[model samples]
Target: MASSPSHLSSGSDLEKREKPLSELTLDKPAESPYLNDALEKRVWRKLDLYVLPVVSVFYLLSFIDRTNVANARVAGMQADLKMTNHDYSVALTVTYVPYIIAELPSNLLLKAVGPNWMLPTMLTLWGIVATLQGVVTSYSGLLACRFFLGLFEGGVFPGLVLYLSFFYPRQRLQWRISAFFSCASLSGAFSGLLAFGIINLDGVGGKRGWAWIFFLEGIFTVLFGVVSFWLLPKSPAHAYFFNENEKNYVIERLKDDGATGKDASVDAFSWREVRKAFMLPQTWILGVVLFCDGTVLYGLAYFAPSIIQGLGFTAARAQLMSVPPFAVAFVTATISAFISDHYHCRGLVLIFSSVMCVIGFGMFLGSQSHSVQYGSLFMSIPGTYIVAPTLSTWLANNAAPHTRRATAIAIGFILTNSGGILATWLLGALSPAPRYTKATIVLLVFSVLMVLFSALNLGYLWDQNKKKRVIREGMDRSKEDPSLGDKSAWFEYNL
Candidate 1:
């Protein structure tokens, strides 16, 4: 039966038979194994397991080191050191000075050295300085340590954001960034609990309770840093767990969302890109939002225990009281980030979170009853924190080309640090004891401003999208060829 069909065919017959195979091959496209839904989910899970904890630990320590001064102040740091002049607030503000100045450059350096080496090393350095803060005798010494601590810790947040961007796509980033940031809230709660234990060690080795707070936290930071160097993945291209096909899929999927280039090459920053970042309206809007959010965040972080004490709680008890709000913040931020990611919506969630903050501040301003006021604190912490990570992740996702994204992130971070400075200065003169009415009012106003700005931003983005659609339809009407018009597509997502 085969002999009849297999006899040498004429060229015309051969061509006719070959045509169907050729058409079949072209018509039935090869299903991409790389884009397998199950595989992508698995990869994401692996990345989450590996990266989230290192980031959480790193930021937890960084946040603790940064804000433990608040705890220390309550633990008799000011009274023992004769810091009666309210220079502690000055010291706190000074920390952000170096932090703002150092942020971009430190992240650039992280690019050069690689995260595995640079991050852990920087963490260790700051940990040492944080510990040294405990040993400072003179006001000048504390100032010096604070300055250096800011300098070293400045790299951690932006560096971690950049690091995660290398591994995850834009939509996946918000929750991871939120998870990373929730460590800050967790640190607040943990620091309180940790301080509660350490304060009991008062007079150990002749050190005050505040000194033990720094000493123990700093040492823990150093230990975690050592662990991080080994555990942290450098980049997706170099990740040990994924195969080559998986790596390529990760890279290609990111390209679909406008990110390009493999993870091995570092994107260098350009002045042109820096200018583009500044020109983006979203950048300025985010700056304002961050400024407002920071006022609430830092005001509460820096002054919460003091405010609690003013409400008639003892110092240790105030520290304990501060824990519940931050604990609420930790849980709320995580839940917000997860829901934001699951829905693939960023702006709406951020606006809702900001509104929650406004409500919290309203309650805080109106109420004097201890339980009601404390309940309001819960709203403030979670609301402030929930917006921040989403805001940051939104900025990161909307910014394009690696270099521009990095610059935009740097600008956003600088704005955030500037907000921290503004927060400190705004609340600077508020009395340590009695009511913090002035600070409370400023925070409430800022929260309202954030809501207004967020609404304006949503409107602006909607208008831009409408304009883009009009432009696209006009082009389609005039086009000779659909393929050529597609190539000329100029629409971009508004941040």
Candidate 2:
């Protein structure tokens, strides 16, 4: 039988290129059976059991802490602190400064510290800061706490994406990312319910309802952080639940999928990798795309409750109303991620979701009826949430070498947070809410641009894939250098 070329090389070092691919084979141990479909399924189930839930918990808290100020607004936070409109917007903007600045550095830190340690540490620090927001007497105090909160929380989402890429193949990554990101939507849903209950604590212990919201949520976050220290595994090699055979199987599966040494932590930071990540046009394309979506996402997350309040519901009723769109979003985003992964078509899925958002925003801009606006929210929320994981995984899957992928993910997230900053100022101050027609129009413009970017991204990936295909078919020997990683001739982009 003609031998299939070996794509499974180990380590991040340049030495992996020393051997020719035609001379290499699937190098499983003699004692181990080749991984069959059933065992692969079992492995995935086990991984999901350990990895997904803990990461989701961490992110859920992150989303809540970052956006809960929105909930607090209706609970009398702005009035109690005597914050002017400008003051509040500045507080929101400051958080993103540290948040964006810390993202890339945090990814590098995660590589050195290991995710199990680094993640819980960030969560704990942010939790303390988030909890302390309850005690703030002035707007400046709120800004300080939020800045620290952003500092701690910045790298987590991107860092987790890099960590997960180590375990799953590119074809399988979107659903996992979506499943993890669904927690953000779930956090949105839960924040509303939690705020509804917490706001009823008005005047208890002489503290306002909004203060209690921060204090309680922070305490829960701290407790969860403590638990994550034990539950979250660093890598396949470090997982306690997996025996030696299972560990080897997990590691081998990734290598077989064209990932080299992804199961190992990228301990040393590389400037070259950083440069490579920046050099890719797709990285900037996706970053700009994320920025556009980020405006919509953060704008909605930080203000959705307020937007609902504008629709004639009481603050409490508005909180309750905010829950459904996010709940629906969680469901739709999970389904979209699953379909994107199953079809290996992240770009198309991203485009579809972007277009949906544009349509929803168009309705929001034109319609006068509250009912139409509310329905438009259902359209907009799911589109915004679904686009996040799909686009993130798309960029991640196309990047090669673990460190380079980490850098790209980090840069992309920085853009995401930058958009969040712009969104805050635009929606909060510039638009003059109670009816943010101007902001809705701005967001609609962003969505229209996102659809164009997504299509362009898809076309670029298709063109690159075709070019690679031509090179691959023309080659007599499949002896490409493995060290080239994603740049290697055999690496195909998922379109």
Per-candidate Cα lDDT values, in order, are: 0.75, 0.83
In every candidate, how many clashes are there? 0, 0
Q: Itemize residue pairs with steric clashes in candidate 2.
A: none
Model 1 clash number? 0
Return the TM-score for candidate 2, rounded to 2 decimals: 0.92
Off by over 4 Å in 2: 1-35, 261-268, 474-478
Candidate 2, residue 12: Cα displacement in angstroms equals 36
TM per candidate: 0.87, 0.92
Tens-place lDDT digits, model 1, residues 120-166: 99899999999999998888899999899989888788788888888
lDDT of 2 at 390: 89
RMSD of each: 8.3, 5.9
